[model samples]
Target: MTERAYFDELYASSPDPWDLAARAYELRKYDLTVASLPRARYRRAFEPGCSVGLLTRLLVERCDEVVASDLVAAPLVLAAERAPAATFRRGGVPDDWPPGRLDLVVLSELLYYLSAADRAATIERARESLDPGGHLVAVHWRHPFVEAACDGDTAHAEIRRDPTWRVLVEHVEPDFRLEVLERGAD
Candidate 1:
């Protein structure tokens, strides 16, 4: 797993290490991620690794309630200011999942940072947290990077191995991959 201190130091250097709010690529990606949601509205949503809340802000438009979390606190502060309607928390996947059933779970640009075990655990936890027929959206950068434990395809391949999820929407580009899937009815 990516250590918390790594993110702490990154946030300390710059509030927007990813430049999620200013870059056109990021803005477009966030828009596409939100736009790809199969449902017009969701009752409740959870967004892990909601850096600076750029996507969280858009997610708010589609969900009645959004609980967004990050490993570090600095970005969560900025996220709260950007998306005041959504709840913010300091946490990450595999170890930190919200209580109750969620209608939507978003794993955006986050899975690659986790160790293999943590990534698998995170996927399982996400599945368990959702109600049957609930949606889960994942979007990640396609290129290999120094900080990532694996490439985006590798991370997503783990998710695809499960037979219970049915893909509702999929979009692949040179820079990224995005998918929206629904949990199978029990």
Candidate 2:
């Protein structure tokens, strides 16, 4: 998993380390992500690694409630300011996994940074926490980066290998990959 200090330093330097708010690519990707939701409205959603909460702002429109978290404090502060409707927490995957049933779980630009064990645990937690027919949306940049433990494709492939999730939507581009999976009913 990526260190907390890496994120701390990154957020210390810039509020939006990835230029998520300023980039057209990120804007379009966020739009596509919400558009791909299998359900028109979600009862509750959890978004881990919600940097600056740009996507969390969009998620609030479709979800009755959104709980968003990140490892760093700086972005969480900015995220709360940007998306006041959504609840912001200082946390990350596996260790800080939320409780209760979720109608939607979004892993955006997050999985690749996790170690294999952490990634599997994160996926398991999402699977266990989601209600029947709940959705798990994962979108990642399809490129290699120094900080990433694995490439985006590899991270996504790990999820796709699971038999319990039924694929609902798939969108792939040269720059990124997105998928929505539905949990089986109880």
Candidate 3:
């Protein structure tokens, strides 16, 4: 199945398909994601696959403006309802990418859904979209899943290989891996 179809099907049956809002594991993950940021506040932030806007709500507290997107419209509706202030759109990454340079770009539990070529393109677009000294944060489940194209660790390893980004922080837990990367001056 295509990534879009898979996500659409997953959300078609359930609102909180991943239990992202109620799960203790997800809450902890969100906490760590916010904590891992080097800066307390950001001018503008972009969050892709902002499922139910759970993380988007948290991001709005620290960001002056936030632009969030999802491939399926189901979650985007919930996200819009949850965080009406945010600019919510229906589009997938690396193709339906948002315009303008961003100070913070977040890829959380989203990259593994993409094929290798799409994933690499997404990372490349992110690198190009970020302003100098901007931040890029990625968080993903560490374990293997039958549906995922690649494990989180492998995806992160590929992301780190980009010379334009410098790894600033890496948090490893039994459940997930989180990395904070800054766009390099060079």
After superposition, the stretches of candidate 1 with alpha carbons farther than 4 Å from their true spots are none
lDDT of 1: 0.92
- The lDDT leader among the candidates is 2
Report residue 156 deviation for candidate 3 (angstroms): 0.4
Error of 2 at 135 (Å): 0.2
Quote model 3's TM-score.
Answer: 0.97
Residue pairs in collision within model 1 = none
TM-score of every model versus the real structure: 0.98, 0.98, 0.97
Candidate 3: C-alpha RMSD to true structure equals 1.1
> How would you encode candidate 3's per-residue C-alpha lDDT over 19-93 as one tens digit per residue?
999999999899889988999899999999898999998899889999999888889888998888899989989
| Regions of candidate 3 where Cα sits further than 4 Å from its true position | none
lDDT (10s digit) by residue, model 1, range 60-117: 9999999999999889988999899999988888788888889899999999999999
lDDT per residue as tens, model 2, 112-174: 889999999999899989998899999999999999999888998999898889999999999
Candidate 2 clash pair list: none
The full ranking of all candidates by lDDT, starting with the best, is 2, 1, 3
